[model samples]
Target: MTAAKVLVAYGTKNGSTAGIARTIADALGEQGLRAEARPAAEVLDPSPYDAVVLGGALYAGRWHRDAVRFSRRHRRALSGRPVWLFSSGPLDASANKRDIRPVPGATRASMRLNAREHITFGGCLQEGAKGAVARMIVKRGGGGDYRDAGQIRAWALGIARELTDVTGGP
Candidate 1:
């Protein structure tokens, strides 16, 4: 039998969220599933995949617009399959230290889509980050990469286990 296809879609401004998505996709792929990470804006359809992991970066305590729009646009298809949601934002180790809840928009999306799970991962902001505030944060020595790769990989592997059980492997 063929492996199940999974899509790890994300919305990011400075590309940190994209990195998280890639990590997730890689972990899922290692578990025998076919997974790919893509920008949320570029994905017009979620129907082609057996499962989807949607994520967005948080700005001003809100989810990225592209991710919100993607969830809205593909609500039907996404709802029909197993779906997971995540938010990346928190330029500190707080996410690694504790469970950070999703922002309002992601919470609503989770409820609407009946998402299997929602997680909040640490964000990253480094030199050359876009926007005045980001640059300022970096200049003041307040910015750094806070994403935990091991945590991300563990989460993705958990999802892979669940999906594999449901789909009878892969």
Candidate 2:
């Protein structure tokens, strides 16, 4: 079978989410899949890809507006293909397993895509690197980098496995 084309689309504030997306794309490539990581803004037309991985950095309990809009705009094309959604948030380790607050608009819009999975992972909190409100919150909350590279790689591998099952090869 021809290698499946996978697009890993992402949005980031301080670049952590972008890093995660790159890791995911790299993992998929290592598995002999054709994968490309691109920012949500630059990734036009989901129609060309066999699979799509949509991701964003969550801010104040919501995904980036652009990422949400991208998914909504390409809902039709995405629905006909395999889609996966992921969010980078919850910097507090204690908040890691907690259910992510509903991203109502994004979730509703993404329903049209019939996304196969939605994964939420811990993110990084970089002081002085975000908007005023976010900076204040991080300062008051005593921020830390909560991103786990190992966990991110594991999830990417799992997603690759699912893709292999769907496409019929490892």
Candidate 3:
């Protein structure tokens, strides 16, 4: 039989979230699953995949529009299959950071679909990667890369384990 296929779809602005999606896909691959990371807009359909991992870049405490639309548009398939969601935009280690607070309005769709998990991870800030407003804000706040690869890998391993529990193998 063919290995289980997983889709890691994300919406990103400065590419940090995309990088995270790629990392997750790689981790899942290491766990013996077939996984591919794709931009949310390019994913025409999620029906072909056995599982879906959806993520988005958070701005103004809200998920990106493309990610939101993908989740809502594929809610039926997503609800029937295994789905995990993540948010990338907390630029700090503090879990209580105000800027990274959950966006209730933006989470309605994911919550409605009953995602297996919704994790918020720290984002990165690089000079020239963003527009004038973002540049000015990062300049004032002191920009630096805050993502933790180990944490991401651990979470993905957990997902792999969950899938194994249900399907009996990664």
Candidate 4:
């Protein structure tokens, strides 16, 4: 039987979220699943995939506008399928957990999709990669790359398991 198609769509300002999306796609691929990772802005349609994983880099408690907009634009189609949402932000692990609540805008818009899972992962802070405001915040607060690859891989594996089960793959 053909493997189900999974779309791992994301938005990133400094590339961290993109990396996370790629990691997820790679993990899914290892499980004998068909997966593709793309930026939310580049995906004009969500109809091609059986499942979608939407993610974005969070800034000041907000996900990227394009990612949220993509979900909203395809809300009906997404609601009928399995969809997962994730955000990469809060470099500190403690902060990441505390930032669990959805941003107000995302919460309002995401209600239409009925996403199956919502997650937050620690983010990376690269020097010279931040916008003016992000730079100021990083400087004042001190920043570091706090992404835990093990944790990320575990999350991806879990999602792959869930998708494979739903699709009756293997």
Which model scores highest in lDDT? 1
**Candidate 4 whole-model C-alpha lDDT, 0 to 1:** 0.81
Candidate 1: where are CA atoms >4 Å away?
Answer: none
How many collisions between residues are there in candidate 2?
Answer: 0
lDDT of 1 by residue, 1-170 (tens): 78999999999999999999999999999999999999999998889999999999999999999889988899988867999999998999999999988889999889878899999999999999999988998999988999999999999999999999998978
Q: What's the lDDT for residue 27 in model 1?
A: 95
- Candidate structures ordered by lDDT, highest first: 1, 3, 4, 2
What lDDT score belongs to each candidate, Candidate 1 first? Answer: 0.94, 0.80, 0.83, 0.81
Model 3: colliding residue pairs: none
Candidate 4 TM-score, C-alpha based: 0.90
Give candidate 4 regions above 4 Å deviation: 95-99
Model 4: colliding residue pairs: none
Against the true structure, candidate 2 reaches a TM-score of 0.89
All-Cα superposition RMSD per candidate: 0.7, 1.9, 2.3, 1.9
TM-score of each: 0.98, 0.89, 0.91, 0.90
Could you tell me the TM-score of candidate 3? 0.91
**Cα lDDT of model 3 by residue, 1-170, tens digit:** 46679999999999999999999999999999999999999998889999999888887777988889888788887768888888887777753333344566346856866787777778887787677867987779766677889888988999999987778776
Residue 52 of model 1: what lDDT? 92
